[model samples]
Structures are given as structure tokens and as C-alpha cells.
Target: MSQVFEGYERQYCELSAILTKKCNSATILDGEQKKQKLSEIKAGLDDAEALIRKMDLEARSLPPNVKATLLAKLREYKSDLNNLKTEVKRITSGNVNQAARDELLESGMADANMVSADQRQRLMMSTERLNRSSDRIRDSRKTMLETEDLGVSILQDLHQQRQSLLHAHDTLHGVDDNISRSKKILTTMSRRMSRNKWIIGTIIVVLVLAILLVLYFKLAH
Candidate 1:
């Protein structure tokens, strides 16, 4: 019984160590990090399988209590493995590339043994942090895009305003030219009328003077 317990403890330690490494790898989502974690997980899983096999063999040689304990442990490992598979499915559901999927699968299986309550709590915290960071990055990118759109809209408005001002300036210039031309025509007509009036006044004074001279000569005769 003591020997069986020792083996179980060793198996638990090995599985826990591998799982810790896998969770750490998940913290790094880069290609190289994923690949390295995948390799480590595969190796760890192999070791775990070997330990389980040894435990199985020892089960047959142990007392009833030890046998029952080993069987229960086996079931726990199976349950952990199933959960690992499901986690892999979730991680790779976002149209991830083949290499990324492979790496996520490897890291997800690194800890396929029953975990302690403390370890579960830590894992949950880590997952939450990662999700929050991803959301923040997405929001920042969206704000930048909106700012760019606003800048483009303002630029278009300025361009239209500049065109309007230029058109107004051109129209005012044409009106000024027309007014100046009309003023010159009006001045020329006024000067011509003044000269005509002077010529007509001189002709009327000459005719009246001639009529007075003829009447005076006839009366004297």
C-alpha cells in the first residue's frame, strides 16, 4: 500500500509540473512559444501515460484499499484528459492557423491529471487576465480607426470651403469689372451732352441778334 501511494504521488507531481508548464506557455501566444509548449506537453503526456501503466500493474498486486484508490485516480486522469480535449477545441475555434492549432492542442493537454483547488483558482485568474488584455487591444484599435475617419471628414470639409471661397472671389472680381465699364460709358455720355448744349445756346443767341438788327433798320427807313 505504501509503495502504491508513493507511485501515485510521483505521478501526481509529474502531471502537475507538466500542467504548470503548459499554462505558462499559454500565457505566451507567439508561434515559437506555442511550438515549444506543444513539444513539452507531448513529452509530459507520454511520461504520465507510462506512470499510469505502472500504477495499473501495481493495482493487481496491492490490497483492496490500494486497488480502489489507484482505480479512482485512473478515472480522475481520464476526466482531466477529456476536459483537456474540450479546451483544445475551444482554443482553436477561431479559424486559427494549422501551426497555431497544433501548438494550442499541445499546451492544453500538458495538464491532464486531476488538479488541486488552488491550482484551479490560479488557472482561472490567468485566463481572465489574458481575455481582458485581448479586449483592451481590440478597443484601442477601434478608437484609432474612428479617429482616422474623423480626420478624413474634416479634410473634405476644408477642401469644399476653400473651393467656395475661391468661387466667391472670382464672382466679385467680375462684378467689379462690369461696374467700372459702366461708369466709363456714363462719363462719356455726360461729356457729349454738355458740349451739345453749349453749341445750341450759341446758335439761338446769334439768330435773335440778327432779327433785332433787321427790325431797327426797317423802322429807321
Candidate 2:
């Protein structure tokens, strides 16, 4: 009896998880992902329904709390399924409306060749509407041309400004290069000056040593 109740509890949990997953997937996924998720949801629902029926057969033996919980979960699952159905219907209906609109337009085009007076009237009205639309388009195109001319002028000004900026950047870079070269030249000159000072001091020391040696030799002689 305990094992039977545990099995029912596990099945209820599985159904609950499936319902939660289905609701989340429907809300978040779209296109092919949505379709795939919906299929999985349906499969889950089928499995849950089967499990519920099996549990129902043993309902008299089940504890009151377990039975109540199962009923509540089933109700919630039914509500979610209804909501999903409504969403699917809404999406499909919108597509149907669009398709109907397209078919109406196509039919109107075909009616232009029909011999009926009513059809001719509709054709005339459609033609007139098209002509008016063409006129408006022509006016819009003229306005667009004027706007384009203004845009071209603005673009030219922007191009000139960009060129000026580029020239300034180049000039600044040249100045930086010149400063760097000057620093290198000054460093080389300072190093040469230090070497020259060292050479001059060595020469002075050698000449002094030679003079002292000559004085000593002359005294000894």
C-alpha cells in the first residue's frame, strides 16, 4: 500500500514538472523551438492523462490527501492546456486573416478582366486609387530628390571637415616625429661629449707624467 501511494506521488510530481516546463516553453520559445516544445508538451500531457486514469482506478484505496493533490494538479494542467490552445488559435487566426487579405487583392486584380458591370466598376475604382497613389508617389519622389540634394550638400561639407581634421592629424604627427628625432640627436651629442671629456683628461695625465720623468732624469744626470 505504501509503494502504491509512493508511485502515485512520483507520477503526480512528473506531471507537475511537465506542466511547468510546457508553460515556460510556450511563453519563451518561438518558431521551430516553440513547435518542438509544444509537441513534447502534448506527449507529456498524454502520459500524464494515462497515469491519472490508472490512479483513478485505485482512487478508493488511495489516501484522501493524495487524491486531493492529484485532482488539484490535474485541474491546473487542464487550465494550462486551455491557455496554450487559445494562444495557438490566436496565432493561426492572424495568419488566416493575412492570407484572406492577399486572396482578396488577387481576386480584385482578376476582376479587372471580367465582363460584368459590377466588376468593371470595381476595376475603375481600383484603377483610380492606383493612379492617385502613383501621383502621390511622384510627389514624394520629387520631395525625396530635393531632400537628397540637401543631404548631398551636407555630406560634402562633412567630407571637407573630415579632410581638414585628417590634415591636422597628419601635421600633429609630423611635429611629434620631429620632436622625437630631436631628442635622439640630443642624446647622441651628450654621449659624444662625455667620451670627448674622458679622452681629454687621459691626454693631460699622460703629458704630466712624461714631464715629471724628464725632470727626474735631468736631476740624476
Candidate 3:
């Protein structure tokens, strides 16, 4: 990811957590407190939305072929943003949320001193859950990065092995040529040795005949 996009994403993540807290805690919505809280959530939502726009800008700035993948991720983020928007809308309006709003307005009565103890506790628990979820997300991202690096290393090793195999193949091709040449040389030498043997046998036969004729002339005398 580009540094700009990463920055935008970091901001978005923080805002997302904040919005989650406000929207979830406001289950009982009412009065000035609920209105003020919703306004803050809306503000955060707007900022998150602006960041999403920036991220989209950054993503689209990439080359066409590369942008496709990032765009898909951006689409998912947009979906998430829409869900957050919907949740806030649902909490702030309609008959379903009207009573809860009244309850929250009443809770403010116990304020400045006590009564929000449970509310605070619930907020704490929500924060903890969000933190744990963030941790798991970070761990998953780390594992993915490690896996990608391992895959690259394996590809490099495979390429080197392929090159070595090609070199060995070339060497074997040369050896086959040498073997053929050696076979021809041996065949030529065998033919010459056979011809030389025949000439020696002819000379031996001629000498023996001349000796036999001389012996016969001596006996006649």
C-alpha cells in the first residue's frame, strides 16, 4: 500500500472504532445526550467518509491493471462504511429507537454523580472487545505478509533449479556429440588394422613358395 493510503486507513480504523462504540452504546437513545452523541458519530463518520474518498483517489491513481485489485478492496471498505451509516440511522430514528432514546435521556438525571456506572462498564467492555478484534486483525495481516514472503522465496529457488537443469541438459547434449565422434574414430581404426593384416599374410605366402621351388631344383641336380 502507498504511504498516503496507509495513513488514510489508519485514521479510518481509529474512527471506525470510535463510531462502533458510540453507535453500539447508544442502544437507548434520547434527548440532548443522544442527539449530541449522534452528531459526534456523524462527524466521525464524515471524516471516515472523507478518508475513504482519499483512499479511492489514491487507489485509482495506480495503473489500470494494478488498480483493479485495490479497487475491489475499496469496494469492501465502502460496504463497511455503508453498514456503519445504516446502524447509526437505525439507532437514531423510528419507533423502535424512540423508547430507548427516552431511557437514555432519563439516565442523564443520575449524572455528574452516579447512575452511569453500568454504562461506563459496558463502554469499557466494548472498548476491550474492539481492541481484541483489532489485535486479531493485525495478527492476520502479519501472517499474510509472512506467507507472501515465503512464496517469493520459493519462486526464486524454483527458478534457480530450472536454470541448473537447463545447464545440465546442454552439457549432456555435448557429451552425446562426443560419443558419436568417438564411435566413428574407432570404426575407421578397425578397418585400417584389417587391411594391414591381409598385406602381411600375402608377403609370407610368396616367400614360402619361392623357398619350395629352390629345394625342388636342388633335388633334380
Candidate 4:
């Protein structure tokens, strides 16, 4: 049980650190990159929430204060997740506007007579904004991919460590079983030796009694 709690604590700390990094990464991003990061963040939050649920179930045996603290952290994490989702929705709406503008330009509907000077200026600005957004998204994606690769490597290392621990545990159990079997064999041998000693002592006493009886009979005669 202690081991379980310890494992949970370690996982929770790792998750918290990852979330903090992700949040920081999001702050440096904007437009589509921020939106994409938010999506990933939402997924991470889901995983975190699942862990919290597992912890909650297991923590029934823990101190009340400890359990309460865990619950509070979970709630806080959830609130942050909600805020991120809201941001995603806002970005999505902006993307829709950008898409509509692109569609109009592609369809040749943005003619000189149809759009005024002010409207053209606004369209140019939107186009430039989108171009910049795309560039940032590209850079952010590269960084995110690198971070993901690092995370995968860490997980693999952890998996290898877990396998090693399991192997060690199995080896220990095998040794324990061998020790138990040896103890049982020694107990059986000791019992057999004691039985043989008791039988030999009884035979000697019977032989002495028989000899004394014969001497008495011979003397009486």
C-alpha cells in the first residue's frame, strides 16, 4: 500500500511538471499554434483527471487531509482546463472567419468594385495576420514534436525500469520458495531421527527387563 502511494505521488509530480511546461509553451504561442497546443493540453488534462480519479479511489485509506488536498488540486486543474477550452473555441471562431475570407478570395468574389478601399485594407491586414499565424504555427509544431519525442523517451526508460523491478521481485520470490522448501525437508528429517532414537531406547529397556526376569527365575529354581 505504501508502495502504491509512492508510485502515485511520483506520477502526479511528473504530470504536474508536464502540465506546467505545456502551459508555459501555450503562453508563448498564439493564433493556430496556441489553438493546437490547447487541444493537446486538453488531452493531457483528461489524462490527469483520470489519474486523479484513480488516486481518489485509492486514497480512501489515506489521511483525510491528504485526500482533501488531492481533490483540491484536481479541481484546480479542471478549472484551468476549462479556461483552455474556452480559448480554443475562440481561436476556432477566428479560424472560421479566416477560412471564409480565403474562400472568398479563391472564388474571385473579392473584386475591386465589390470591396471598398477600407474593406481591402482590412482584408490585406487579415491576410498578413494569417500568414504570420501560419509561420508561428509551423515553428510551434516543430518544438511540440521535439517535446513529444522527449516525453516518449522518458516513458520508455520508465517502462524498462518497471520491468527490471518486476524481474527482481520474481527472483526474490523464487529464493523465498526455495528457502521454505528446504525448511520443510529439514523438519521431516529431524522428526524421523527422533522417532528412531525413541524406538532404540525402548528396545534396550525391554531387553534389560527380559534378562533380569530370566535371572530371577533361574535363581528361584
Highest TM-score against the true fold, candidate:
3
The stretch of ten residues in a row with the least summed lDDT in candidate 1 is 108-117
The local distance difference test score of each candidate is: 0.63, 0.61, 0.73, 0.63
TM-score, structure 2 vs. true: 0.33
Model 1 bad stretches (over 4 Å)? 1-124
The clash numbers for all candidates, in the given order, read 0, 0, 3, 0
lDDT of 2: 0.61
TM-scores across all candidates?
0.45, 0.33, 0.47, 0.37
- To one decimal, what is the Cα RMSD in angstroms of model 1 from the true structure? 22.1
Give the alpha carbon lDDT tens digit for every residue of 148-211 in model 3: 9999999999999999999999999999999999999999999989888899889989999989
Candidate 4, residue 99: CA error in Å? Answer: 46
Q: On TM-score, who's better, 1 or 3?
A: 3
Give the better candidate number (2 or 3) by lDDT: 3
Reference-based lDDT, residue 84, model 4? 41
Q: Which pairs clash inside model 4?
A: none
Query: What is the lDDT, from 0 to 100, of the residue 38 in candidate 1?
Result: 62
RMSD (Å) of each candidate, 1 decimal: 22.1, 26.4, 9.5, 23.5
Residues 161-218 of candidate 4 have per-residue lDDT tens digits of 9999999999999999999999999999999999999999999999999999999999
Off by over 4 Å in 3: 1-108, 111-121, 210-221
| Residue 80, model 3: Cα distance from true site in angstroms | 20
- TM-score-better candidate, 2 vs 3: 3
